[model samples]
Target: MTDLNQAIETLSHHEEGVFPRKALETLLDNQEAVNPQLLDYLESVAIDPTGTIESWQTDFLVVALFLLAQFRDVRAYQPLIKLLNKLDSETDWILGEEGLSRILASVCDGDVTPLQALAENPEIAEYIRSEAFYALLTLVCRGQWDKSALHDYCRRMLEGGLNYEGGYLRISLTHICEMMMFSDLLETIRNCYQKWPEMSEFIRFDEVEESLQSGEADEFGLSFHRDYITDAIADLEKHACFVAGDGAEGDDLDGFDLSELFGSPDDVASEVEGFFANAETQETFVRDLPKVGRNDPCPCGSGKKFKKCCGK
Candidate 1:
């Protein structure tokens, strides 16, 4: 066998971690000696019909491809694209999902055609939704595409929120919005909040608040916060309406005893007054407490430290 063929055989037979690491290092060091052999191996791995490639192998291949792409090796493009398509075809393989995401990100450096193809594939749409959403988000953020497309896509996805089979997708949409800094997407989330009020409480308003405070605002800016908060309040109002309709059946008043529920007016007033009095006392005690930091003196007045004391 030729020297290059021997190197390829040695790489294939070695364990994944060490072999890929060494082979990649060698390829980077001696490109002329190993480039053809490396390309051939990638093609074989990309077309492996048995689906026997392990997660480590997939990770190595993806990393190798990413490195090649970074070098602007035009020869790597077709093979990487083929691997991406193959990964998209194998939805049952979780490793493929990760590999495809990495590959898409790597190739997205220049040509977006592969991503567009993946986005347009119906069979892989659901499986590839998050990656596609993110890629489009990157495009919008980088001014590569018109914002209208992203807005329309987000709107369509949110419109189907009620029927979504995966909660992760819903959460991912929120993440994508945050990443893209697209405040317009807030309206879509608002529609979702209107449909499901309980979900309103779970929304991370603090992140939005922080984003706004940091001046990292993107398209639509602070309007995102205003719309989101307004929608949450509307959902809360709807919740109140439902409670009113449920009347005595509502759990809002269900946890009390008979006496608490329908007691003498004076007795109820006294109990309420006592409850508030104790609650106020507890609140005062808490409010009067000294703040402790890791470097601060202990509340016990110990000279050692807070973290070293009761704070521990």
Candidate 2:
């Protein structure tokens, strides 16, 4: 039986792309012992991001995150939420917005009060702030939160409860309503378009009507956590980037996409590094759009197609 610290150490410093499968399994097998230690380590890194990230040669941050997420320990909630608040949006490129949101949902253990507050907080980076909603929506879809309660909470959001600047919180809340098919809030939603004409530019008022009337879940909404499973080892090794030896970050198939997660391709860093690097750099407003046509004008007002712009 390897100690948790030993297991973590074994997983670290893999410049040669050597994954210690045995060490990771030790963690997975002893989640009750490992989860809190993982959170503590994450908090330590978060407390001194630059120093720690610069010091880390091992991908312990990524390992800890996936483990904590799958364990679904409520204890993991505050530390991850605190990091979400501290990291801001630039990390969006690092973890992929959906990826981070999945972690948030996984760790919340069905308690969404923190997520609601984060989603409604105007001062938080929109990318990070909006993640709370996506995570909450996932929990709702998973039946962790009552659909009626979610419906009511979304109604409150649309009815000026989200009354934050940047208009993103409101837009995000509306998307939640669409996902939940909360048709009861249609009039309230219509009022939003009238109150803020620019809202239509992000999502057409007509599409909202169509989606709500469909009597089915939006495909995008249905697809949130399909890959965020509970088996931590499988979660790690399923991705070739996380594998080691020749299968790891050698010549080709290389580490995961840095543009989607970290560095710049040749570099195989994880979102944990980027999240610790900066707390504010502005998340593009276009990130709030849902299932927008690639051919549509980029919502950021750049006039480029969505595919060519932020959607890319």
Candidate 3:
């Protein structure tokens, strides 16, 4: 067999943690030298009919796709896009889509119509749709497309409320506002805050508020709900149970009968008060117990250092 064929066979069967990425990278960089072999291997991996590619092989396959995108040739575009279309919402496929996004953005060619269709397709899973939206937005930010068109899309996107769904309770529309260098959409988002108070978490209200308070911005900014103290007080009141009269001295409230357990109210009150007062002092003594260094001998009679015996 030729040397390139030998390299492909060697790479596909490489053991775990023994990836041939550097060699593959060299071949990908020199596309003219190894295009035939590299593309053949990519097609074989991408069209695995049995769906039985081993985990390690799957990792290498995605890396191969990523390297093809880095080649920045139109030839890699259609294959990557087709692979994206065939992918499902499975975790593995989601990861593959992420790799596809990099390829899509690099070879965007100033035409985002395909990406926009995917972004607006409600039939597709949000994971993939969000990736498309991000890729589209990335093109606009990179000056690959006209700003006015993307701005209009951003406005329309905000009109229906951001469709972002992921961790951290935030979305990318706020980031788009910064990237587009316009605050009109931001104002619209803030205006919606009165009706939807949760929008504050997604937008960085703290930074804006600080900026406004410092006279860094002209407007007073939107009203943010900083009612943490009020919420905390409400929680305390909910948990507070106020007995009508003295517990031990009067008829036992809540039927607990504290007198039976301890004694009369006077004795119980004195003991409890004294216990609280002395508790702090006793706690200090307990906390002041000599610190046992990790390397010091264990105090449990193990005859070993603290780290070796108890710390472990």
In candidate 1, stretches whose alpha carbon ends up further than 4 angstroms from where it belongs are 1-22, 32-39, 49-60, 74-82, 85-102, 120-122, 125-127, 138-164, 193-312
True-structure lDDT of candidate 2:
0.66
CA lDDT of each prediction against the hidden true structure: 0.48, 0.66, 0.48
Could you estimate the TM-score for every candidate? 0.48, 0.65, 0.53
Stretch of 10 with least lDDT, candidate 3: 220-229
- What residue runs in model 2 are displaced by over 4 Å at the alpha carbon? 1-23, 30-33, 50-58, 90-96, 195-202, 225-229, 233-312
Cα deviation of 139, candidate 3, in Å: 2.5
CA-RMSD of model 3: 20.9
Candidate 2, backbone clash total: 2
Q: Is candidate 2 or candidate 3 better by lDDT?
A: 2
Name the runs in model 3 displaced over 4 angstroms: 1-3, 10-21, 36-57, 91-100, 161-170, 191-312
lDDT for each residue of candidate 2 in 1-312, tens digit (9 for 90 to 100): 447778777766544345578888888888778777888887876675556646753267777777788877667778767766666443423232224566788888788888887777666567676667777777876778888888888888777777464344566667778767788788998888788766676777888778788877566544643334477676566433354434333556556565664555435455655765664575645665455565443455332245545775
